[model samples]
Target chain A: MAKVGLFLGCITPLRYPGIESSTIDVLEALGVEAKILQGTSCCPAPGVFRSFDQEVWRALGARNLALAEEQGVEILNICNGCFGSLSESSHQLREDPKKLEKVNNILSQIGKKYNGTAKVRHFAEFLYRDVGLENIAKRVKNKQDHLKVAVHYGCHFLKPRMLKEIDDPERPKILDELVEVTGAKSIPYKDKQMCCGAGGGVRARTKDVAQKMTIQKMENINEVGANVIVDVCPFCHLQFDQGQEEVETKVPVLHLSQLYVLAFGLPKERMGVEAHAIPVNF
Target chain B: MSEEGEPKLVNPEFTKEVIKRGADTITLCFQCATCTGGCPSGRITAFRTRKLMRRVQLGFKEDVLPSDELWLCTTCMTCDERCPRGVKITDIIMTLRNMAVEEGHMAEAHKRTAGMLIKTGHAIPMGDKFRELRKTLKLDEVPPTVLCDPKLYEDVVKIMKATEFDKLIGERIDG
Candidate 1:
């Protein structure tokens, strides 16, 4: 069992502890040792902070990566926004020594150094590539045969295809396959690859625009008859869960960890399914 | 309609600054509207990512820097990914935003969120009801995050101070 540091970005720890708990439960159930990343701040939200100051964004991201490197473990992050920031910063710093030097100079003031050692891995990629579908299939005790899932591969998971080359950016099948491994049907939906309208600081800077984007996504999901939306990022989860309330829709949203925990035969109580704004009937 | 020619407003330094900020491929754009066609924000708002690209190439710094349309971008990267010219459209938008912040042209909501981030390490801080919800789930009332630890919160503030992020967002380090 590989011990991996978990980078729980701001939203997951503060807004949705359920996703945090379920992530731990699911990873532990899969025989992977998950440790909380100590003394970590926000992924700082790449869209928000990066837009304001790229140097600060790189420093913050490098700091988080250095934490995982000090533990001698790669990071397994739950939020796609964190994946974007950490992975992009790690990639940039690793590829460019000058940038690494600049970032390390900033980090050294606070007793830290990023030697460009740690790598960032999103939880979806971890479950699919590291855990393997066959191994996950064997452990599934409660197959969600009755559930129809609309998989939301949040933008950061597979965007800027150069930086995050995890899957086919246009038509990513990894999340769909991972969802299917739990015996749930990953239904096809319109604009499946569209942004959740929450990323890039849209949700903060402009409410009506963000809500309109969410409403459009919810309408697409409704058209596909998906009872619940399964997402990998908590920011996207928040957009779908709470964003639905503003749009007057009731589509239940589940983090991939929550869905995986559910299919692992863990009760809803253990997965913290009750914390959802739109209750999950199953 | 009298044909009175208005002065052409062009600041070549604007284009140079954007490239220096990491949108080095801005020159590759050939007025292709693919970015605008694919922009999600453009669909719902007055933001045209392609037009912004054109404005950058033309060095329309004054027009581009202080516009509300600049903040309308969600930075979804859809435009960047699909651009035929291989222009880093989204990064350019981010660069423009950084310049806007330097000129004190930030949106109010974004400033408020930045204040929240500096204070709580979260753009959207968790409310009390959500704290109660965590307890119901048998998890820590406050997850072991910056919100739960004073030292960690200070570390976040320290990084902000070092980067002058607090100052950029109109925050005081002493506070």
Candidate 2:
């Protein structure tokens, strides 16, 4: 129930509005005041700079951080990619004064300066921490008793631990806990820790690589007989949901927001269910 | 192995944002070749992410952009996750791909695909053949939201403008 800025990266807002609609529903139901960050861009992601120039990565990411800082609020990210890139980059700037100064110098040209002033949080962390799982379950007027869900922890949020304050890095429990709030069963599955093929912008630049990884994740989820896979990151959600068709997988994928909307008994249209590639019958 | 000031010639048009957007991840990589080692295309050939990163960081734009190896990356994100430094291998590749498009350096096959994506939102055209497949599977479908909306490009551009990516790119292109 805290006021925060909602950061939806390049793909989520217009491309996947269902995810946004559902995310908003859950947060508002909990009495949280979420304002969308108007000036945010691509996380500008680490891969771009880590490949092109070391210094520029810090600057672009810091610029993103500075924009959130402009609002003077902790920014909760809907995409795991954005959360991972922003939080990790913020940590880097705060930890290294020299690097921070160089990044700030670049930002000054854009009229922005980041001293790593705000906190970057993923929705999973916000849900379990701020709203509390017990509180979320209390509002579940309609329960999805038949929906068997697989909780996918996106790699960026799951990796290089200590940054993800919500769930344990290895064997994450928070996402599973959120699924339970809908009265859905969160299945235990193998390769549950695997990365989505879409992250790091692979789905955009490289199709074969992205599709192959999607196939691997698809096979893993199928192996467990999960009816649907639930996830936090837009990158991950797109991969398993729509990207599954890049190969020939049938199991549907759901962003956590999408799934939660269903459990909340909202209209399927509002959940943007029609937009999904793998149709969610539930 | 090279000496400094041998005339450090970065392409002037490649702004800090351009470089940052595309290949900034070069520094986060080491020469482990894990990216290449696990690369789906590397199974058939010897494409290596480490080598690609090395070239990009060195500003070997031509080498990085048009390489058949660069086109072969599948973007599994495994390497991005595996990197001990957590460098994003896929986004780096995307940046290089985007630069190739902007510079008209894209290979014949690559340019055609980008054109297809711009027009269809998919890399391949769906003439009658795909419709037949959809009918066969009973997989009735409509254009994805990102594609169905006539104004998707304008909306995306607006978001980019919101983030000032437009301004960043404009500055470099105008100059």
Candidate 3:
């Protein structure tokens, strides 16, 4: 079994621990070792904190990468935002010697150094690639054919297509293909590639604006009659799950991992269903 | 709102400064509105991605920085992905935001989040509610992270200090 460190960015462990637990359970069931990366901080959240200071952003991100290097494992990021920040930081550190030197100067103070050897893999991409769709299809103990999921390919996971070669950012089929493997229908929705409006510090700084965007997305999903909103990112998970209350719309939201957990015949208790503001009932 | 006010001088230095910081694509924008048209935040907010790029190109630092419009972007990167000119619109916005912060133009909510990082090493710290939830899921009450280890948390604080994150975010006050 291949062992990898799980990079659980803030919102997953702090706001939705269920996503973290479900990811571990699903990965373990898939015969992969999922160890939580210790001493990791926020991906520093690219849009919020990274916008404030580049040096600090790179330093902290490199610090997290360094921790993974210590454990002798590649990072398995559970959140899109974490994957974006760490992946971008790794690319920058590898490409720019000056940046690596400056970030190393900061890390030296804390007895850490980012050798740029750390690798990050998004959980969804890992499932589609390493785990193989056919293998996932075989593991489906409880197929959820009744689920009409509005798949949300959150911004960072696929956008800036030059950097993230995961899929076609505008017309992605990776998530849809992955969803089908579990016997769930990846229903088409209006503006399916649109963002959930919880990113870029908008939700944190301007609630009304973020709420408006979330409402717009919810309306689109509602129009398509998607029974559930399935996303790969925890922040997007929070936006859809909790943002439903503000928009006065109730569509049970599930992180992709939880969707798999349900398909794996895991008990609902393991998913922390009660933690969601929108009740996730089958 | 004064139409008769003297026209602001275009500071070429500001444009050069942003370009130097790695948003060289700021100059590649040819005033095409592809970025604005695809922007989701622009649809609901006063943010205009095209105009912001234009302002940056013209070195209108005063117009671009210190404006609440800067905070409205969701950083969704839709504009960046759709630009025909291949301009890195989202990256330029981020670079502009970094400059905005240097000018002390951070939003209050962002500052509060920054403070949280300073105190807990995680912007969104684990609340008591999640602690109970984790326990029910048969997981560790506190997921092994900077939050559970003192040495790791100390390293986080030291990095924050080394990078002047604590200084930029200011001191955090207890709730």
DockQ of each: 0.64, 0.10, 0.83
Task: Please estimate how well model 1 matches the true structure, expressed as its whole-model Cα lDDT.
Answer: 0.84
Better model by TM-score: candidate 1 vs candidate 2: 1
What C-alpha lDDT, on a 0 to 100 scale, does residue B4 get in candidate 3? 59
Residue range A205-271, candidate 2, lDDT tens digits = 5666767766877777778777888888776777777676654457777888877777767656657
- Per-residue C-alpha lDDT of model 3 across residues A162-235, encoded as one tens digit per residue: 88788989889999998888889998988889889999999999988888888999998888888898899999
iRMS per model in Å: 1.6, 8.9, 1.0
- Lowest summed lDDT over 10 consecutive residues: which window, candidate 1 chain A? A266-275
Candidate 2 residues lying further than 4 Å off, grouped into runs, are: A48-50, A246-249, B1-175
Angstrom error of the Cα, residue A198, model 2: value is 1.7
> For candidate 2, what is the TM-score?
0.67
RMSD in angstroms, all models?
2.5, 8.7, 1.9
lDDT tens readout by residue for model 1, A1-282 = 457888888888777788888888888888897888776788878888888888788888888888888987879999999998888878878988888898888888878898887878889998888899999998899989988999999888888788877888887899999999989999999989988898788888788899999999888998878888999999899888888875555788889999988899865676666666788877
Residue pairs clashing, model 3: none
Per-residue lDDT of B58 in model 3: 86
Model 3 C-alpha lDDT per residue in residues B19-63, reported as the tens digit of each score: 999999887889879888989999998889889998899888888
For model 3, the chain A TM-score is: 0.97
Q: List the residue pairs that clash in candidate 1.
A: none
- Error in Å for residue B18 of model 1: 1.2
- How much native contact recovery, as a fraction, does model 2 achieve? 0.07
